[model samples]
Target: MLNKNLQNTKFDIRFFILCSIFFVVTSPFASCSAPPKLKTQTLTITRFDKSTITLVAEIAKTEEEKEYGFMNRKDIPDGTGMLFVYKKDIHLSFWMKNTPLPLSIAYIDSKGIIRELYDMTPYSLAPIIGQYACRYALEVPQGWFSANNITVNSKIDLSSL
Candidate 1:
């Protein structure tokens, strides 16, 4: 009688284990039926020589805005950039700090001429110190200007901004 009882207990345990595995294997497909929604905004920024590079830009205007740049965003759409507008052109500097995207920053003077360009790696907090006074700084994906043939002294169109 005791042997029969042990065998029944072992069978019950095996059945329970099989049920657990079946549930675990099937749960993932049930929950992964849809893609998660994301938030996005529209923006536009132009470049020199009247050539407009329309893109979705995340604008950073104030001190708070500058401090919290694009920290959490993983992917930035092609032709989109982050624009940093300041009151005056001065010795401006930026760091990778919390920014997770690899970017190239174009430093523009008050006249909107491209003064300099710096390529920054993701999560690098080193300061992007500018040698001259700059009024605007445009941050785009690394090699964006080079790939688009944009260079220093090139004119950036911002009449629409």
Candidate 2:
């Protein structure tokens, strides 16, 4: 009877250990809290006059990221641009609804050429429309394009990404 009782206690201990192990392994996934996002790469772009600008871009690979792109970002670091990627080529327009940072947006073509550029004010909520349909739009600090002489018909190199 003592041997049987010892065997039962061992089984109970083993069961408890297995439960603890399962919780340790799977608790992270079961938690509803979202993990912090990770950045993959830093992008470097050039102006029409050959001035270089280094930007840490947030990749808009998903629909949600594209939709909520830079909406609440109050300050964008100088010499950096936010790169927005779309699944397909379409007419893209951005408004400063929730954005509180002054920005200059560049509409890029499929060949990574700047099709249009616009300087936008912070917290305006006014629609900053693109002149032509583009596959991507890059947001930089206000007057960055003009200051660097980056304009329409200028090519943007994405080889660094």
Candidate 3:
């Protein structure tokens, strides 16, 4: 009986440890893909008409940061956005899973020129894929591009990033 009780105690401890690990791994981001706010920098957009607009950008340099994106974010103030960076120009894709904010994404070439612009619906499961090779993607509140007169071929000053 004493040996059986010892084995049962060991099993209980192991089960408790496994459950604790599971909670720790999944608890922080368990609610609606909520992610911690990332680092921010000043980014400037030079429009095709030669006018310039400056905004603050949250830099998403890591894969995890890029994946979480603005998920569960309810409010995106005007003049602020997120910048997703890559090592080289490639086909860029995005989805609005668990993201409630309607956004406009500008796919930018390695030279910092806007290649394409796409408007994304909130919580949309459809993938918004880019045909052009792009090194970066900038997401802002919907209609921000047209509102600011920033259109395709506009130069984004990546050097300031």
Candidate 4:
């Protein structure tokens, strides 16, 4: 009777351990939640013609945020974009890996003037490098710059952001 009881106790312990492992393996999938929405800021672009355009941009200030720019997004609203802020002027490179939006990025200097512009293909791993050192980068839907007449040297008004 004693041996039988010991065997039953061992079986119960093994069963509990297996159940714990199963829960640990499946917990992430079972309790998964939607990703948090990014924070947005208002920014304005001033063309050489003196005309101004306003945009609502998600601010990517942290390294993690900058790395995850626009990834998995199904769509971006018109007049919406992303602003990647850096602490200092540096040669910045961006890639479209895991990002679904067709985007155009403008590398901007500390004075808020766009220094270079490049169009990025969706999901491409190729790096789109800035032609000059930049303190910020603005990303909008592909063709937005040309369609709106925004080009290199166009000023971005970050005072309101």
For lDDT, the strongest prediction is 3
CA lDDT of each prediction against the hidden true structure: 0.76, 0.75, 0.92, 0.89
**Per-model TM values vs. the true structure:** 0.66, 0.67, 0.80, 0.78
Consecutive 10-residue window with the lowest summed lDDT within model 2: 31-40
Ranking by lDDT: 3, 4, 1, 2
lDDT of 3 at 82: 96
Ranking by TM-score: 3, 4, 2, 1
Tens-place lDDT per residue, model 3, 21-134, is 999999976775548669999888888778889989999999999998999887999999999999988999999988888999999998899999999999999999999989
- Tell me each candidate's RMSD, in Å, in order: 8.9, 9.2, 4.2, 4.2
lDDT of each residue in 1-161, candidate 4, tens digit only: 99999999999999999999999999966523343467998888899898998888999888878877887778988889999999999999999977888999999999999999999999999999877999999999999999999988899987654
TM-score of 1: 0.66
**Which numbered prediction scores highest in TM-score against the true structure?**
3
Evaluate residue 67 in candidate 2 and report its C-alpha lDDT on the 0 to 100 scale.
63
Q: How many backbone clashes can be found in candidate 3?
A: 0
**What would the per-residue lDDT of candidate 1 be over residues 1-161, giving only the tens digit for each residue?**
99999999999999999999999999967733332232233533344554655556676777766766666667877787778889877888988865778999989888778899999989887888999899988888898888877778877655545
Error of 3 at 56 (Å): 0.7
Ranking 1 against 4 by lDDT, winner: 4
What is the TM-score of candidate 3? 0.80
